[model samples]
Target: MTQTKKTAKILRCPSCGMLVQPKDEDFPFCSDRCRKIDLGKWAMGVYKISSPVLDPDVLEDLDGLRDGQSRDSDEQ
Candidate 1:
């Protein structure tokens, strides 16, 4: 009988779609640069949740907050 060694798990980088190993410092991403780019996209609102708002009360609260902020800015 023969035994075979297992290979490390591989994943694609979210920013550049490059293959990465689980053992890497940036496990899922290819490098530090790619990781930072992904963060930048999130900070810049390039990515957003694709689901509808199920709670009407939460939506109303968010609208109220927006209105309050605009009024405060106008007063300033």
Candidate 2:
């Protein structure tokens, strides 16, 4: 006979840092309150997703746009 071990994967709630299981009603969040809190943070801009501009051509265009805007402001 062979014995097998089962491991339950646990996750922490994003809002409260409470240990939660994937089978929980909230799945990622511990409760509806915590889920709402996370949503509110997003709505209030407390959390932001940032990605680097990896394209060199796009960076050059952005720099040119800034320069043009500054020149226009200076002319006025």
The best candidate in terms of TM-score: 2
Best by lDDT: 2
- Model 2 has a clash total of 0
1-76, model 1: which lDDT tens digit per residue? 8999998656799889898887889868899999999899999999998998779999999999999999999999
Cα lDDT of candidate 2 equals 0.95
Model 1: CA > 4 A from native:
1-10, 55-76
Error of 1 at 1 (Å): 17
| Candidate 2, poorest ten consecutive residues by summed lDDT | 2-11
RMSD of each: 6.2, 3.5
Worst-scoring 10-residue span by lDDT in model 1: 6-15
lDDT of 2 by residue, 1-76 (tens): 9999998766899999999988899979999999999999999999999999989999999999999999999999
Residue-pair clashes per prediction, in order, are 0, 0
Off by over 4 Å in 2: 1-7, 50-52
lDDT of 1: 0.90
